[model samples]
Target: MVISVKLLEGKKVAQALDETMAKRVESLKEKGITPGLAVVLVGDNSASAVYVRNKQRRAEKLGINFQLIRFEESVTEQELLAKIDELNNDSAIDGFLVQLPLPDHIDEDKVNEAISPNKDVDGFTPISVGNLWIGTPMTKPATASGILMMLDHYNVDLDGKNVVIIGRSNIVGKPTAALMLERNATVTITHSHTKNLKEITSKADVLVVAIGRAKFITQDYVKDQAIVIDVGMDRDENGKLCGDVDFDDVKDKTSMITPVPGGVGPMTITALVDQVIELAEGRING
Candidate 1:
């Protein structure tokens, strides 16, 4: 007897999410509320450009008003903070986020603090994170929220499951742990210096890897029939795009797994639009 493994494609999951939100987006427009999202880019980083472009494209498709505010590398921290204040006060904008990896001169934490919690669709602000921990989150961090949406769509029950997340970055791991805990899953987060990494990972019912390594989590690290979510975007030795998990090596061993390019990538941007729509709706109701 053979157990057939399943692939959880993120592109399809993202599409389904967008489809569900399409009518809601149009409904906002029907009521004279056009959801708006703005992305502020401090410098021209290649990776940040790719993310911004993806968000812009998806926002247009979903009928959300999107804007990219580009600033030179020399832009001062004061200038960036002031701009965030402006956007926060701008009634047209429902939500906004400053693209990460801003110039070294700018204090990233301070910038996040400057964005109004109501408009922080990226959910990086202290207020947003605090809300999440208190069990009454307003807008979730997009990537983490997107991952949860994917898991929920696939009917992956989180109750009482052991979830081990291998990246502790604020954008992915920490928030994701909070979400799993919300679902009654026991969560453990491992970072760069984690000892006996494989031993811990092998016990997880669900594994999510986002450590920015290429093919780092192989068959040895994953438990049999575990659900794997790969949040990495990396290039293999042959210049082929791959995930942190070696999909070919680990796919057969897992009950379900998400691929790199078509997996978690698509859902990130879709979640952004969903947050903007929610913010816009709230504004209208208030």
Candidate 2:
């Protein structure tokens, strides 16, 4: 039996979300409120720069205010913390985040902690993470929320489903598990040390791969007709962009799968901008 594989393209999902977000932004404008978002980028990481640019474009396109704060690689930890304090009190800013992988001198934890929970749109603060697991999320980690948003867009029901997540990082794997568990799905998280990895992954109704290695999850790791979400942004042996799942080798076996570049990437910024707008909406309703 030949099964037609459906592509869960995140760009398409993001575009659909943009239309609604634009209307919401316009409504807030009519109420004299503008959704404001800021991103603090430290050092000169090319990948981080690209991610921040994409975010700026998306936020401005949706009519939300976007701010980019750049700091030199040599900036001290205290200097970064001072800026975080300023943004924390900046009424014009609704939500903000400091890009990860700060230089060796700065403490990433100290920076994340400095951002007030109310303005932690990146959802990395302890308070935000605590809220998410308890099912009263103030702001969700964008990538995990993006994955959930995509599944919801495709009408893939999660209740009582079995979900297996590859990688255990705070950004994707663990948070994705928390959100999926909230939907009543049984969640399992695996890392490099797990024994019989394929046996574990093959049983999942939905599989999410965020492991950094390129093409780590090939056809054998996936079960027939399982919904696969790949969160990896990696370069293949040929120096081209690819995902953790080998798309060519695994696409035919899946019912719905997200492509490498177009899949989980776009939804992330969408979720972030949406969170800022949601917070702005709160300003008036309260």
Best by lDDT: 2
Model 1 steric clash pairs: none
Q: lDDT tens digits, residues 113-181, model 1?
A: 999998999998999999998888988988889888888889999999999999999999999998899
- Separately for all candidates shown, the number of backbone clashes (residues 3 or more apart, or on different chains) is 0, 0
Off by over 4 Å in 2: none
lDDT (C-alpha) at residue 34 in model 2: 91
CA lDDT of 122 in candidate 1? 93
Worst 10 residues of 2 by lDDT: 105-114
Give the Cα-based TM-score of candidate 2 against the true structure: 0.97
Tens digit per residue, CA lDDT, model 2, 122-167: 8999999999999999999999999999999999999999999999
lDDT for model 2, please. Answer: 0.94
